[model samples]
Every structure is written in structure tokens, then in C-alpha cells.
Target: MKQKKKMTSTGFLLLITIVLFFVMYAAGMVIFADKGFAKPQMFLNLFVSNAGLLVIACGLTIVMITGGIDISVGSVTALVCMVMADLMENKGASAYVAVLAALGIGLLFGIVQGYLVTYMGIQPFIVTLAGMFFGRGLTAIISTDMIAIKNKLFLKWANYRFYMPFGSTNKKGKFIPAYIPPTVVIALIVVLLCAILLKYRKFGRKLYAIGGNKQSALMMGLDVKKTMFKAYVLNGFLAGLGGFLFCLNSCAGFVEQAKGLEMDAISSAVIGGTLLSGGVGTPIGTMFGVLIKGTISSLITAQGSLSSWWVRIVLSALLCFFIVIQSVLASAKKKK
Candidate 1:
């Protein structure tokens, strides 16, 4: 008789997160009933508000699965937004051109960091740290001030919304429609593509092999350097995409844009079931992780009396708890 394999730690963590989200959401609805946290719009708003973070978290999940990290993604996102804003607002460039330029910069930045990490034998942390500083410095050099985006095409896209079939009535006796932003749609597409790439592609398989054990992957004749390098490139591209979505949400850019956003992405990825030790994760799980953060923030907002910093405090605590769980899981795997 064939025995069924035990559920993996990643699977277990993902299940926990899924349950946690529903539990937290239910708790919020019970506590903030008067504030209408139970509305469908409130739920839809989670995706609409966190579309950018979704993309960023997906990118971070990919890199983490390859047993590497990119602390510079948030800075890269800021740089992308700043560059796009400057090009459109100051240089009189077309929105299309500005967006392409931002994507190109992100790709270039990723390639350089990847090259240093994979070819030059530099540590991922040190290289990404340098990349982070460089990105932030370039952003400031462009302009320390916030630059509002006034491009007609960009504005049109930002304002475009797709309303859901169902809606809720506000306390004012008016029908409030639920809709998702174009950015949310874009983020969803990216997530789907990433999910496919990671689950069904040869490159994705190699990444898992490498992350599971570099020596074994090398023995199996995988192109470790090339795969790792391409992983960073993909991460960079996604970061750029995330920056564009974030700009759509904010309609402005500044040097401080997306500050500490890397932490958010990382924490989200971790919470989503991506192991820091690598070789275990899913994009779908990361999406849920992003939603969890959005839900927390929404709950805090509904409370009204809570400090905004409460979100950060709660997130940090959750991050710590997840990391501890990962550590325990790793230890168990080693023992087995």
C-alpha cells in the first residue's frame, strides 16, 4: 500500500494563514458592526488598496524561493515612481515612454545586482543594500519633493474602475457600489502569470532544486548562476510593475515613496508561506498574505480610536511569530 506523504510545512503554514484571515475578518465584523466592516466593498477594498503590495510580495516570494533576498525592491519601487513622475511632469515625456523607462531601469538594476551576487561572488544582502542606497540616492537626485502625476492617459487609467455585480447600502441610505481599480486587475494578472511560471516552467523547477540544495542542483546539471540571475531580473521587473501600480494609487511620487515597503513585501511573503530557507512557497498563498495585511489595516481604520502605528505594531508581531514558526518547522525537518 502506498502511504500518503505528510503535509509539508509550507502547506501547513498556508492553511494556517487562510484560516487566520477568515478568523480575523470575522472578528473585525463582530467588533466593528456599526462601522460596516461587513460590507462587500470593505472586502473588495482590500485588493484595490493593496494591489501594488501584491505584486511586490509576489516578486519577493520568487526571490525567496530561490534562497536569495532583495532588500532593494522597495527602493527600486520608489526610484521607478520618482523617475516616471519626473519624466512625465518635468521632462514632458509621454506616459508610455515614462513607464517603459521605469521598467527598463528596474531591469537594469536587477541585472547589475544579480551579476554581482551570482557572478562576482558578492553576498545578496550587501549587494542589495548597496543597490538600495543607490536607488534612494538617485531618487533624491531627481527631486526630493513630491511630484504629482498629471498625465492625462495615466490619470484615465488610474480612474478606470470595474464595479462588481453586488454592492452594499451605506448608513446614509445610499447604495455604495463595489469596484476594483485597474491596478488591482493588473496585479491579479501578474499573480496568475507568476503562479504559472513557478508551478509549470522548467526555470521554476530549477529554482526549487537550487533552493532546496545548490550542491544537488549543481550535480543535476542545472545552470545555477543563470537561473539565479534571471530570478533577480524577474524580481526587478515585478518591482517596477508594483511601483507603477502604487503610482496609480497615490498619483504622486517622492523620494520617500514606498519607504519600508520592502519589509511589508517580505513580511507578506513570509506570512504567505514562503520559507526563508527557500524551496517552498506559492504565489496564491502570497496573495492571501497581502490580503491579510490589508484586512488588518482596514480593521484598525474601522476602530478609529486606535493609533495608526497599531498596524505596524501588529504587523511586526505577526512577522516575528511567523519567523518563529518557520524556525521551528526548519528544525523539525532537520530532525526528520
Candidate 2:
């Protein structure tokens, strides 16, 4: 019962934040949107357009909750994206083959990082930081140019949209499309898997225990090294998945893709009330948190006037604000 209440409180906090984001977004639209601040499509774009980031952020959330961080994800994702595109276009691999290749690449990278963190006793931060550099350097070596995916299967998947006709169309001549985006589907799958693992599975409970107190968990006979390794391995794998979805969405991959994504992922997890101090969080919360971050960028982009840099600046401020709130809240909880 006590745990349930805590979950409720955390959920309420998340809800309040979502409301606040909407308020800020509405204000921005009113002042900035030239067409009187009313557009239905704007709302749709929030979840659909930035869906790839949403997926990646969700994956990053899992690693953060384990009392660890992964900085290499952004660059690794870029590499996966490039690999997928290159394989499909130049190597004439089918979309399915390219996907397997991308995921396999992600798995391989995850294994390397996991081995370092768990076996070598390297700090997750340092290990992943090295990973970040290595991945980015490889991406640089691969090419700085944006490569597009012209594969027919890939193109159809990207453009596939579901439409629900509501009075023909809206003010922008856009239909009320509820079409599924591959990125959104992938994000949902991640969310569902995380939910099941964290809530209903023994491994998930073990994860929580490990994060709560690594020494205690080890003394309790939990396989600390294996769990930690899996955390990082999974993190790397998800980064790769995020990369594939990202490239699919943009139809290309560049060395600079998903830059600063680690920060964004960390921010999303923290904002969702996942403790940086370790232990306690839900993928559902993380999903909402990513949506909030994505929404901010979408609002800014919709205006088409504000510099894209504002997206980073605005998110940074919000990230700090949420971190402060979390610190205060955690301290108060401890005092109680």
C-alpha cells in the first residue's frame, strides 16, 4: 500500500509537468504561431515526428534507473543508422536483412561496453564515455555526409500513415491521420517490454534490488555483475535500435545525428522521477517524460522562426528545473 501511494504521488508529479509543458507550449503558439495558435496537426506531430528520439530516450531511461549512464548511445545510433542505410542501398540487402544487421551491430557494441563495465570494474560513466568517443570517431571515419535510404520497403514503412477522416480535412488541408509510425511502434514495444520486465518479472525485481543497494544485493546472492552487464548490454542494443528508427525516419544517417542524446536520455529519465541516486522508476513515467521533451522541440519547430538551438536551451533549463525538484523531493522523503 505504501509503495502504491508513492507511485501515485510520482504519477501526479509527472502529470503536473505534462500540464505545465502544454501551458508553455500554448503560450508559445499564441505568441509565435502566425495562424492564431490553433492547429490540430501540431499536436499529432509532437508524438509522431520526434518518435525516434522518444524511442531512444526510453531506452536510455532503463540504463539510468540502474544507477549507471551511457553516453555512447547517440553516436552508436548514428553508426547503426548508417550501417542499415549503406547495407540496404549499396550492398542490396533487403530491409529485413538490414534490420538484423543493425540490431546485430548494436548487440556487439553492447557486449563490449557491458564487458568493460562488469568485468573490468570500470565505472559505467568512464566506460560509456570511451564508448561515446569511439562510436563517434567511427562514424566520422564512415562519413560526415547524410546518407538516404531509397529502399522500397524502407520508404513504404516510413510513409505508411493511418487516416481517420473527420470532416474531410483541417485548416492545413491535412487529414485526421492516426497512422502508425514505425518509430512510435518501436517506442511502444520498448515501453511494453520495460513495463513487463520491471513490474512482473523476477529479473526486474532483482534489477531494482541491485540498483537500490549493489553491495546488499550481492550479499543477498544476486548476480550483480551479470545484471549490470545485461543493463549496459541492453542499453547498447536499444541505442542501436533507436539509431535504426532514427535513420528510417529521416531516411538518412550522418555523423552528427542524435548528438547530445545521452544528456537528453538522462534528462528524460530524471524528469520521469527515476532516481539518479539509483532505484525506483517506471518505463511509463519515462515514456511520458520523453514525450514532454519531444513536445517542447516540436512546439519550437512548428513556429519555424525560433532558432533550432532554442530546443536545446529550453530543454536544458527544464532539465535543471526537474533535477532540482527531484533533489528536493528525495531529500524530503528521506527526512520523513
Candidate 3:
């Protein structure tokens, strides 16, 4: 009975998110038709542009599912980007080596943050907040100036595009094939794997269990601390890879990189039907949430008159809307 209730709630939230995305996209298509918003390439750009955020947001989803939050993801991304940039541009390191460094940086943060939160029983917010400051500070220590990655291999990966068969035509009636980069492929794979893990894996069940009720989970013989520790570790690794992907897009790194990204990830997860209090969320829903955000940006850019800050205003409004819905549902459930 409990499982059924959970499924019903999840499905309801997912349906709302999916429908909202399509509605927003459709409206954009209608309003911005002259700007080619209806084009396949335009749709694909959403995925291409936000591939890194998608991955990072997925990691946030995992942590949120366990009723824990990590506010340091954005800083971690900055740190990773700075480290990679320094290694490749200044140290004459190969892209392969930089990749290793990215993973290692992420793992190191994860281990420390996870240990603090789990073993030492520190509040996740406090631990990750310190991490956030440390990461940004360390990034500045590496270099105050920006580092543009000129590594041939890294640029090759960045510039490479996979063209789709169907696309729009130019004024001369020539077909223009839509293309996507490798980052989109990687991001989508992460989403799929996360979805599968949450829906089918034992670890996923444990996450939901602990988030739903830590006491009940402990009574049921679940190791709440260990599971949460693993979640942070995994989130750290994803944040690292996400930073790499974000770096791929920018191909440059500085102290100010990826500022406010933690909020974006958190909002994306919440808008996608993940409860802030925890125990309920899905990667598929989060994917649509990301699309909705991308659509908002594309719409604003196409309008050309609106300030970019409007995107935040609109997103905050949507975030508030969803939180209200979640609270309403929670109240109803309690009453039942």
C-alpha cells in the first residue's frame, strides 16, 4: 500500500513536470517561430548547453534523496575547472592527465565531505558550506587570472560534433544537419544510469528508505550513515565529471566560474518533483526540469529585449510554485 502511494505521488509529480516542459517549449515555438525555435538544432542546443548541469543535478538528486544537501557542488566545479585549466595550460599536461586530475579532485572532496558528514556526524550543510568556501579559495590560490585550455586533444573533443540526419534548411534550400557534442551523449547516459539505479538497485531503495524515515530504516537494519557516505562520494565524483564537462563548454577557467550553480542544481532537482525534505525524486523528471530551464533561457535570448536576470526571476517563481504543490501534497498525505 505504501509503495502504491509513493508511485502515485511520483507519477503525479513527474506528469506535471513533463507537461510543463512541453507546454513551455510549445509556447516558445509559437512565439519565437521566426527565430527558429522550432528547429531540431534549437531543441538539441538545450541538451548541449546544459549537459554538465544535468550531470551535476543528477548527483544532487542522489544526495537530496537521502535527506542530505551538498551546497559545495558549484565550488567543487570551480575548483575542478581551475585545476584542469592549470594542469593543461600552465603545466603542459595532456588532456588525459587532466581528466585524471579532475576525477581525483572530485574524489578527494567527496571523501573529506562525506567523512565529515557521516563519520563525524556533522550537519551536511555546515560541512559542505565550508567545502564550498575552501574550493573557491583554493581556486584563487591556483591562479587569479583566467586560463584558457589550448590542449589539442581537449579542443578536439570540444569541437567535435555528431550531425543528425534531419535538420532545417537554409535560405538557399540547403539542408543543415543538426549536431550535438559528446557531452550531450555523456550527460544522457548519466541520466539513464541514475534512473536505473534509483528505480531498480538496492542502494537506491536504501536511499529512499532512509530519506523517508531514518528511524524506520535503522529499525529495518539499514545502515543510514554508510549509505549517506556513499551518496556523497558518488555526488563528488559526478560533480567532478560535471565540472569537466562544463569546462569543455567554456574551455577556460577562472575563480568566478560556475557561480550560483549549486542553486541551479538544487532548483532543477526540486522542480523535477524531488521533495526538499527528501525520499522522492527521479532523474527523468530532473531531465525535464533542466529542459524547462533551458527553454526559459532560449526564450529570453530569442526575445533579445529581456534582461538575462529575468531567467532567475522566472525560475524562482517556478520553484516556489512547485514547493507549494509539494507542501500541499504532504499535508494531504499526512491527513490520510
Best by lDDT: 3
Lowest lDDT 10-mer window, candidate 1? 1-10
TM-score of each: 0.96, 0.89, 0.96
Name the TM-score of candidate 2: 0.89
Model 2 per-residue lDDT at 152: 96
* Residue 69, model 2: Cα distance from true site in angstroms: 0.7
* Stretches > 4 Å off in candidate 3: 1-7
Candidate 2 global lDDT = 0.76
Error of 2 at 271 (Å): 1.4
Q: Per the 3 Å backbone cut-off, how many clashing residue pairs does candidate 1 have?
A: 0
Which tens-of-lDDT digit does each residue in 1-336 have in candidate 3?
233454676678878899999999999999999999999999999999999999999999999999899999999999999999999989998999999999898888888999999899999999999999999999999999999999999999999999999999988999999999999999999999999999999999999999999999999999999999999999999999999999999999899999988988888999999998999998988998888899998999999999998988898899999999888878777777
Candidate 3, TM-score vs. the true structure?
0.96
